[model samples]
Target chain A: MAVTLSQDGRFHRQLIFINGLLPMVLMGFDAWRGKLGVNPAEFVTRATGVMTLVFLVLTLLVTPLRKLLGWNWLLKQRRLLGLFAFFYCCGHLLTYLAFDRDWQLGTVFEDVVKRRFIAVGMFSFALMVPLAVTSTNAMIKKLGGARWAQLHRLTYYITIGGVLHYYMIVKSDATYPLWFAAVVVVLLGYRVVVSLRKARERVAVGVER
Target chain B: MNPISKIPSSEITPEETFLNRRFFMKTAIWAGSAVATGGMYRAFSPRSDVKSTGSEIATVVDSTFQSSLGADEKVNSFGEIAGYNNYYEFSTDKSAVAAKAKDFVTDPWSVEVGGLVGKPRVFGLEDLLKMESEERVYRFRCVEGWSMVIPWVGFPLAKLLSLVEPRSEATHVAFETYYDLKQMPDAGSAGIDLPYVEGLRMDEAMHPLTLLATGLYGKTLPNQNGAPIRLVVPWKYGFKSIKSVVKITLTNREPPTTWSLANPGEYGFYSNVNPKVDHPRWSQAKERRIGEAGSRETLMFNGYEAQVAHLYAGMNFEEDF
Candidate 1:
């Protein structure tokens, strides 16, 4: 039974890996075929940003899913979801720097400050970097428990910045931003409720003692 | 794959995504969705893609005819006239005016100069241009955030207003853009205030800073850039520089501008690019020199304070602005 369960887990892992590579493959194929048009960088960068938001929301859903569905095992996949979110975020940032501005530092800096959309995007990128760096067990251990958790709390800011960036960049139509904002509200609400419950239990225990 | 298993797997599992599932199925579901969505967007959208269909694009008569201007008057690069736009009714996209504005009917364009004018006359584009000398290069500033210097070819608004012969009661001059909600798709959108109009105080209207542009880059103004005629107030935010103007009404009372009414805090009557007055969303400390990659420090009144600042005079800019 243990071996079979391990095999299933491995299969899921492989599935996740395949899923991650698929988008990149499709992007490459589109570029090669000249179907994606000349601005492949814009496409790739925008896709990565949207995917990052999607995965970040998914990562935040682990705790809620565990409570709602009695699926405690969902917690085990949280880090994987978070790391995938970070990966896409890195890709998004790289594409902007490499293709959008042709790796011009001055132009990139100006865009980050001068353009409202770029500024929000850069803020989101800034937040994601810290979360990505501390994702590893060694770094998490070095930062200690409370500090590590506090550092990861920057995800809330990141999600806000990402949504704002998406909103500002688009010339018109805000349905995507509205959807992401809704998901983020739910995710953050769940965290707040869970934290309140934990705090209440701690206070109750102390009073009883 | 088995749905019957009740026991939760103890081992830490990696995550999976929709794309991964699609890959396993050997189908690009995401790409398919994107293409379908794009198609739906195009089909449902009222505005036609001007670039797609070879609609009546205005002939760029003179390819190398950058307007003649003094060295001090010229910016390093006149922003891409193709992109720097004022297509208020259709859309706000910089490229939208150039791309989708050809469909706009400009041949029969006329201006109704009424209100405090002694002779309120509706003059056609041909008649109007014939009345005034060609054009002048002016810097274009947008309210949404961006600035551009364009080699605009048009005579001063003061020049035309002087010809009209205004009454003493004309304290404010209001200009209205030709607004057809059906034709200009963006007019119907909740985000924008329809029938886009802007006003200038009597002094500003009479000032040399004000222009009524008929041509740009020594060519007839592109339909997207308000081909027939448009107001160009160099010192104020771009929205104040109204476009595709069909009417100019000089009234005794100050007219409420479309932008100031839409967003009171961000856009004011005197939306001078003052570094001191930051926009609600972002700072106006630096502006990308239109057509150039690098940005320069944004000056007070977009570097036109010396000439136009006196018009504000004793009025507190912070209060009225």
Candidate 2:
């Protein structure tokens, strides 16, 4: 099915931007009001990390949804979602650095080296940097679409790494992270199925010709 | 329309003077009346039950029991201390434990003290409380890298062990937390092997600082904070202080602990609070004190090193951890 990009793309983009900012604003308000509960630092850190993963998963869902559901308008919002994921990833790291670690670079460095979850989390955030930097139209045009798409493919690995980081960090319960992992697997599975179908369709077209 | 304009500037009391006057009045009332004998002021103090979660406060006072406080340690507000807990038998979420444990019935509680003791016996909660109890404010450190200073009311474990009369063969003491599927809804789903168990070497169990806490902050232990009776081993991580204890067994071998049984490598049986020893998932060098802004350096044996260091003498700290 051929899907046309809707003229309401700008409106959708604005809505996405506001939606992305809403959690940040709410978290700030909660922090100000002592509503984050006993360990605000841990609460904020986990919240931002979860938000980052949520946005990353949503960003990944865009491609499969566009192909499977014929929702081409969803493609336009992918960059915003990816940027929001990066924003929250930064928030998660900053919360850990400023509040939890008190900006002790040495301690953080030690943790990144010693703790498996911290190391994986740091790696996932580092992977997002290039994709975030090249999210612009100019960068896409400069790098060409094929190369840009290949580079952005790091998102899949980032998502996996983020989920692993979360799964490993939790003391015992892995229910939430396992659920996130299941979602990623389903989304990735959809992509594989769509590609197989496309391959089969191409063979049918060749045979008809 | 302005309320402030109705009161003349001279007639208005300064905020400092107003607060001081209120404190003065409260002190005067507390000192001058028969209510003073009943400790009415303590019951009605602003800090007593602020944000309390409806846990009963025991009226028993151990007037003779007193202990020194740490130099700069401040008692975490009753609400904050009680509001936050990690009783996994009840729930995993720290803040959820209090509410979830509200319906838990801890009375008619009996502790079976057995194994290597000369005589195995079960004692009711009231019977245990009949023993001498004292108040000690100690720094509590959790394996999750959080800390709190708690004012615990209890007697030393040594005194209890003396009554039980452990046999010469006793090498370790193991404690089991009460686990009723009906009362603790999460017990079936907490993933840990149930009837949460913890252990200490014979010497560690007999340490002077080891307490069988019955209350906290001059109140009966909240269900969430381990009601009826619980162990309070301040030098070790908080989990070592098993909550809602039911059985204490003296054994010749190291008994399996809940966390250790779940993940032996991550949680050792001797889970003492040591800054030098780090958990595989996180650092133990520093801990975020609950209600405090920033992390502080975690102490060796949680600052009871002078008392506990000899227990681990000549042993590899990493292996013991």
Give chain A TM for each model in order: 0.85, 0.91
Q: Please report the TM-score between candidate 2 and the true structure.
A: 0.85
Q: Using TM-score, give the best candidate's number.
A: 2
Residue-level lDDT of model 1, residues B164-269, one tens digit each, is: 8999989999989898866776667536666877899989999976788777665666677777688888777776888889999999998988878877876787
RMSD to the hidden true structure, all candidates: 8.2, 15.7
| Reference-based lDDT, residue A104, model 1 | 68
Model 1 achieves a DockQ score of: 0.13
Model 1 chain A scores worst on lDDT over the 10 consecutive residues at: A1-10
lDDT of 2 by residue, B1-321 (tens): 999799989997777777677557645643444333223322211121225543444534555534444666678878778877899878877877887888899888999999999978899877887876778788889899998899888888888888889999999998999888998978877867888999989999898899998888777788889988989998999989999889999999999999988998999888989899888987898999888887888888898888788988898878988
For each predicted model, how many residue pairs clash, with residues at least 3 apart or on different chains? 6, 0
Q: Please, what are the lDDT tens digits per residue for candidate 2 over residues A1-209? A: 21222445765676677667766776677667676677778878887898899899999899878876888889888999999999999999999898767897788887788778889999999999999999999999999999999999999999999999999988876777999999999987887898899999999999999
- DockQ by candidate, in order: 0.13, 0.16
Q: How many Å off is the CA of B290 in candidate 1?
A: 2.7
Best by lDDT: 2
